[model samples]
Target: MEESTINSSILGTKEYWENLYQQEINNYLDHSDPGEIWFGKGLTMKMVKWIKSKSSQLLPDDGDQIKILDLGCGNGHLLYSLYQQGYTDLTGLDYADKSIKLVNQMASDLGIVNNLKTYVADVLTLYKSNLIPERIKFNLIIDKGTFDAICLNPDLDLNQVKSDYLATLEAILFKGRSFFMIASCNWTKDELINMFTKSSQSFLSLYDEIETPQFSFGGSKGNNVTCLIFQRLS
Candidate 1:
């Protein structure tokens, strides 16, 4: 499907996300056992490696910790992986209550509760409320499946919503140095690149686009996922 067409339905509102959670909550719960979360340890390691490869050049001279915000951080798998790799300043936001609960429980169970924070909030609505600190910036922001969900929403006003989202991202992202990494399956390379190019024209600059290997379990063979990295330039 065309990117614009996908965004027209999914990226337009919170109701879309809520309904998605309602439909998928059981599947998420069923799959989130101790060793059966969406991405296993191997994939999580690969994700961290991809994140680090994109973010290493942006690290501070003093080696001060970098702040990472993971959008739609289901079960905190990626965040947990980052913590294991020594990146502690991490925060995750998602709209699903079940996901939040599961992630928190997972963190507590694994004893990394002190290093992570998970919030139940829509990324589109995060800035409107106090879910995140005002004027806060992140060195890195990661999105895996969030945008795909947005595009799956059946009521999004594609152009306007995407424009607003891009602007909001610009406002919240660290100026001139932050990196945004998004992994998506529904969008092809050209479509993803075009969307980022258009979105970055106003707030960021294209830094890199890399193809990442994806793993699918069960009877499904995972398709290739694209990881698009953008750097704030304004």
Candidate 2:
């Protein structure tokens, strides 16, 4: 494993995100915009569309609850977009209070407050502590930039996180045929796949992969982002 230069000592702590989300909420209020474009809206659209493409297996019915969960759902933009697509059972979880508050405000401003749910709870703790019961009942889970930040933690046990993630998904995905879509800028396509294949179980397996739109970097095409899709099989 190669070391990266991220403030794990800080980022791995709850205070880090609380402070960050506070600033983000301030920006949203002052500038009429949300902060941080993880992989950009284009990548988010690509993910949602790809899931929609697998409608027969991943979706319920049009305008019906699909029981969606958005992990580390900053500002609730992703949740808002899913609501626009008619996914009713949409929930957003974050460790920061401001993140949850902003998402709730966003939902209200968009007139979908009743359709979307937002909670302020540490997601990493979900593996052991069931702070939110709804955490284990999602049919579709979307993560953008959450794992990237998590993997940066220096004390991280790579395989343990994998096991915990799998456990949480298996517990919640009442809809057996569920999809977990993740977009990340820190990991390569191969690295993400290896994270699962190297620690395989029958519970969740890789379903597909999508390369985020690339850009010219160092005189060659480079994709700083990638989307990996996994399906709950047990």
Candidate 3:
């Protein structure tokens, strides 16, 4: 797909996702069997490990339940992994309405509906009008493919979008917390590092940068698919 097309596809305001959900719902009604697409087993296991490792380090005190917010939590697959790992306090934020529906359905199927919260709102607009409660500061926020999707759009004004994303991230994170961002992009490591450092200087401290192997399409390979774990410190 052309970059312009991909960008235009998701550039709309709230109405975009609402219409998307309606279409998905109609399609579901028309189809007899609809199968789910999963984040592959290898990828899921890697994420699970990452979550577990981070949670273990952060949650040193026993009986302290950690709150996690999965930004762009498509279908809640990562949330499901965290749920299986015994993290009960979880919330998923996704702009796609169909994704929220599918996530809720999956949660119900897995009997974890009670432990997860789903929100359908633009990431940039989440805090406007106090849409997200003040008491909801997450211990960790995980971004898998959300950043890639945002950057992949050709219609996006890159600098403006980055500024908005950074501001929103700072608003939501608690002091000394972390954001684990996994991305696959053509940008160099130094560029990404500089971007994060510049954007998060006021609210976050760069703690660790992990270079992990990530699979790419067409049997290609990429290094440092960059899992950045930034500690929120104001």
Candidate 4:
């Protein structure tokens, strides 16, 4: 895997994230604002609905048995929305401590603190790290713009980071039975597809995709966001 075409930016640095989340924390305390919602509030609900529909087909029997992990879960809005829809077993991970703190505060405010657990863990260092317990394996894992942020890191090799991400996914997800869904605003559909499928240790297969709104520019059509779902093969 080579570097992503996306240019490096400050958004890739942990320091940038910490400062952003710290400001969000201040705003949350002062004005009761829940902070940034990533792409938008609507996208959060859209992801929640998509997960609900897929879990029905995949789990079928007991929704509680399906454990889900949100990679780079900023402010934990997605997990919070999922909890509202009756998905209880959820875990969220973010590298910034302020991000985790804000999420914990939000969860505590809603009195659903026990429903979703959050931690401060960097995705690039997730494998073999003690941040998340080793025994826990998720049935469904999701990412909303995390990989895009990672690819923006000018310090680390994007290819190595992508590999580390996939390796982390392999470690935490149930083999052959788990699903990974990602929504990205930066990468094209084809670029994202090749990133996962063309890896040297590829074990993921395209399961399905969600249709997002499209925009036309200069007579060329493109999506504002791309949502792809993949399953780990045995």
Give Cα-based local distance difference scores for all models: 0.69, 0.74, 0.66, 0.86
RMSD of 2: 3.3
**Error in Å for residue 100 of model 1:** 0.8
Identify the candidate with maximal lDDT.
Answer: 4
lDDT, candidate 4, equals 0.86
Order candidates by lDDT, high to low. Answer: 4, 2, 1, 3
lDDT of 3 by residue, 1-234 (tens): 112223434534445545755565555557722233233445656766777777666662444677788888765667877788888989998888877886777677679888999888777656554868887777777777576667656666766666777777877876554554554344545555566665533465577655566667788766645566677666
lDDT of each residue in 1-234, candidate 2, tens digit only: 552233455666567777888888888788878777667878878877876787677655444457888988888877777777777778898877877988877677779978887777766667567677653477788889887777666787755666676666666665566788888777776676666545555366789987667789679776778888888766
Show pairs that collide, candidate 2.
136-172
Taking the candidates one at a time, how many backbone clashes does each contain?
5, 1, 1, 0
For model 3 the TM-score comes to 0.76
User: What TM-score would every model get versus the actual structure?
Assistant: 0.78, 0.84, 0.76, 0.94
Each prediction's RMSD to truth: 5.3, 3.3, 5.1, 1.8
Clashing pairs in 1: 9-153, 9-156, 10-150, 10-153, 12-156
| Stretches of model 4 off by over 4 angstroms after superposition | 1-4, 60-64
